[model samples]
Target: MCRWLAYTGNPIHLEAVLFRAKHSLIDQSLHSRLGHTTTNGDGFGIGWYGHPTDIPFRYRCIQPAWSDRNLREAARAIRAPLFVAHVRAATGTPSQETNCHPFRYGRWLFAHNGLVRDYPAVRRDLMLAIAPELFPLIEGSTDSEVMFYLALTFGLERAPVAALERMVGFIEETGRKHGVGEPLNMTVCATDGEQIVAVRYSSEGQSRSLFHSTSFRHLRDLYPDDPRILAAGQNAFLVLSEPLVDLPGWWEAIPESTAVVARGGEIEQYPFTPELA
Candidate 1:
């Protein structure tokens, strides 16, 4: 399991959410409260969309986020309209740079907080399912990276939600064929430099924890004295594996087995089920 945060709103320094929050993602990397492991020191990564290009800039390394000096430096210097950051606690894979989260393809960025159970048993089937053209794009051995390419193979560019559903369905179907009782447990976030889609789901119905912040304007009002909220764009929204701060009414726990789409300051939630196609 792991911890991650996705931010889309006004352009602000990455540190504001990655390091400066009350319980920032960097803090979670070392002392996570809700993750399976308290220390996610395997590795970390950050991806953000900057101007002049639709594609995101990514910085990933197999270093603990809390002690990475370059991460601290970059977080303070870079600002973007949207970004995704992750700290990894390798479930069954080695801690390698390519295995870090916020995996990217073209204009898309993705990260996951859970695993595909019995991945080794089902890995070959899932890998073969990926379109050959897209297969070469997979650079890591983590189930998370495979899931990303699987979604891409299933048409993530055209329909993110549907593609992801199909991806999970494929994993679940393959896992069951290999006798794995529960195949999927994930809180996933994906973005194409515009709209962001997040899903909290599992084959067994015990998905990991996920939270989303209220509108920035509303949060500013709720915590008038908090400079961090004041600095965020009015339309900014944050979705994370856990609450970055303890401000009441500022964070909402997303229901299990749910999909949340956040775009243009509006957030919508819908019941999530694997498409099984």
Candidate 2:
């Protein structure tokens, strides 16, 4: 339903990963090999932190990413240590700027790559559950935005993984109550400037595509002489809806019903479930 990439380490120009990689996020907008659809041109967005405590800067548009002149110029000029880019293919919702991905709130930036089946049928129930404070902040009619606010209402800032787990659990339970099949297929990425938490799950047990890169240090050791790897940080890591390149050992798939947390150079994985109160 969408394509996204999250990068942490090395304050390289956004183009380094958004456009330079062999199969960059820009290219994925038109040639995604692992997403549910090959072309995710509905809309796009990019969010990045200027400093650890600053609210993330974001740009979202209703136009296709490849055709956005501002995005092209900005990609070349903006640089950051951690950021997220997403190209969406709206699932029944209007294709508008607010409906684009990489949604932001406070210091957090979030994007998703799948949907809540029968979202329309359950949209009201889900929205009503969000805390009143966050309810007015939702600016779009997409399931992705709803999911973001849901995480916030459930305490993402204090306990990200658990909040998200509870959100998914609530979705599955709500979906089943509405007799909706294949409740969800979501590969979500979120960052609060310092650390990132990514989740992969689906009620059907088979999720949409998602992968994370090996550390720049490990890649350099493997290819000893690969100069590109030399320019990256020892902790440079990338999480994507699809591999940025065809390089072997460059990426690893996050297991189904699991969440991966990356802070600096340390990464950890935790089992996930689709059931919530």
Cα RMSDs of all predictions? 1.1, 1.1
lDDT, candidate 2, at 165: 89
Over the stretch 7-30, how does candidate 2's per-residue lDDT look in tens digits? 888787899878888888999999
* Alpha-carbon runs more than 4 Å astray in model 2: none
Candidate 2 lDDT at 267 equals: 88
lDDT of all the models against the reference? 0.90, 0.89
* Reference-based lDDT, residue 79, model 1: 90
How does model 2 fare in lDDT? 0.89
Q: What is the per-residue lDDT of model 1 for residues 1-277, given as tens digits with 9 covering 90 to 100? A: 7999898887899999889888999999888999888999999999999852588999999988999999999999999999999999999899999999899999999999999998888999999999989988888899999999999999999988999999989898899899998999999999998888999999888889999988778777777887777767788889998898886798899998899999888899998889786
Which candidate tops lDDT?
1
Question: Where does candidate 1 stray beyond 4 Å?
Answer: none
